[model samples]
Target: MEDSYRHKGMRRQLVKVVRSKGIKDERVLDAIGKIPRHFFFENALVEHAYQDKAFPIGAGQTISQPYTVAFQTELLNVKPGDKVLEIGTGSGYQSIVLLELGAEVYTIEYQKELYERTRFALPEMGYKANFFFGDGSLGLPRFAPYDKIIVTAGAPTVPDALIDQLKVNGCLVIPVGNAKTQQMLRLTRLEGNKLRKEVFHDFKFVPLLGDDGWKK
Candidate 1:
């Protein structure tokens, strides 16, 4: 549970691995180095925390792999004080990264257990984010028009509500595809409700579930 020197050293090595994999953003690399990923796992699995792979975080959800996290975050192009809406809080790892990068994050989780668990866990680690439990696909309308939005789970298609919630100049990063694999997409809202879309490489993620996502 303790973040000792050895754990910090391991995180440094993990940062190096992520860097070598072409995560050129220095701020993203630094956040990866600073966050104690081990703190998010059970003590028995803590040794594997620094690995680039994903691990089960209870509730059938897995914390995303490090490279995927870096890649998605880099695509987000986060800036300090940006109001970011994150779908799928999961282990709260990604939210912590955004918070570390000076973002004001509002995150939602569909699974009640995961939401409750992460809601408390994050603040305990000195990280803070507005946490909510609901259908993430609907987007948080109360806090709509976010400066940036990131969806952590894979959706069959980008939710229309998410696009509607984005600010005119805001960006949305999501993974879209079928159950098996997804293509990463970045959507930038332009004038006249138009959006500029860009596609990145493929990734695998748990299916996004909600009214706008996969049916229960």
Candidate 2:
């Protein structure tokens, strides 16, 4: 069918653009290529889903741009079968990407509406990210000791609680800065009570809402 060919072409184009823009991980690329982003959007935006742009999914959150999703996944250092905790379930796109990378994910989101939307969509998409409704910035204490963690929403700063929940040597990738702007931050756990911070370029995302994030 012509429609199927067009969908495949769009998928290939998305991967080409994302890689040219510096998405280096093959696993990340493959994951991005496979997921049907349109299914995560309102039907009106289905045609635009593969355009590599973020779209407003109700409840004050936007599905992150495709490249950013790939970037965060690569930075989180996901390994096959790693236990990954993702904060901010947002349109469930990022959670789907994590599942593609073979990570066992646990995700939390605050807005009740967005939480339920994602929960309903996950099983239908054949994804298995354990969904939780709560203040995401607190991080899921029940799923501590994760091999890697990622926060889809931007925070004012990294939370101490998240740092405590990581397994020693685990990696956490987050966006941290003032509400208006953000910088990508990578934290890797070192030996006993030690953490290494790596700061990358500036980016913007929806406010990470919780005690460790913006004033909410």
Candidate 3:
């Protein structure tokens, strides 16, 4: 009964928040409503799961706010059955959203603590993303040519490794900036060795750590 009420409130907030934020994609909106956010957090957050604010999930990382998550997912332009690669699987919320939208998810998490917690939390939520414990800045080369790649972390610049992993006409939505802040960027592989890029939004996230990102 409590879970039902919580999910109901979350669904209501999801619609109100996404629409007000100008995320006009119907599919994205539906996916946001369908996924249950409380499942990703500990019992304490089941009530506040509907709020449009980032929440602490330990290890100095956070589960992104609803507006941010909705905005970013809409930017991905996801379609059913698409294969998605997600960098920085904090709390596994982004991965869950992508999966709910009918994408085959392959996610990477750099923090061991967060990764394990997410690994346990995700299965219970009815998702089956291939989760990896590694450096997210180094795109998962083994699964090259993803249909869509979404990086939740912010880098100083676009990672060439990630670019190389994109399929023809595939897209990668990432953030690029310095230690203090970052700007969201979208890179799309056109064709025949040509690529196109665009800036999506101005947002902040923890620095993406690895060879292809900020040193810190």
Give the winner by TM-score: 1
Between prediction 2 and prediction 3, which has the larger TM-score?
Answer: 2
lDDT of 2 by residue, 82-122 (tens): 99999999898999998898889899998899999889888
Q: What is the C-alpha lDDT of each candidate?
A: 0.95, 0.87, 0.84
lDDT of 1: 0.95
Off by over 4 Å in 3: none
Worst 10 residues of 3 by lDDT: 1-10
TM-scores across all candidates? Answer: 0.99, 0.96, 0.94
Return the number of clashes found in candidate 2.
Answer: 0
Q: What lDDT does candidate 3 reach at residue 137? A: 89
What's the C-alpha lDDT at position 209 in model 2?
88
The better-scoring model by lDDT among 2 and 3 is 2
- lDDT of each residue in 122-188, candidate 1, tens digit only: 9999989999999999999998889999999999989999999999999999999999999999999
Arranged by lDDT, best first = 1, 2, 3
> RMSD of candidate 3 to the true fold?
1.7
Model 1 lDDT, residue 200, Cα = 95
What is the C-alpha lDDT profile of model 3 across 87-196, one tens digit per residue? 99999988888988889999998889999988877887667889999988889999888999999987888888998999999999998887777788888899786888
Task: Report the number of clashing residue pairs per model.
Answer: 0, 0, 0
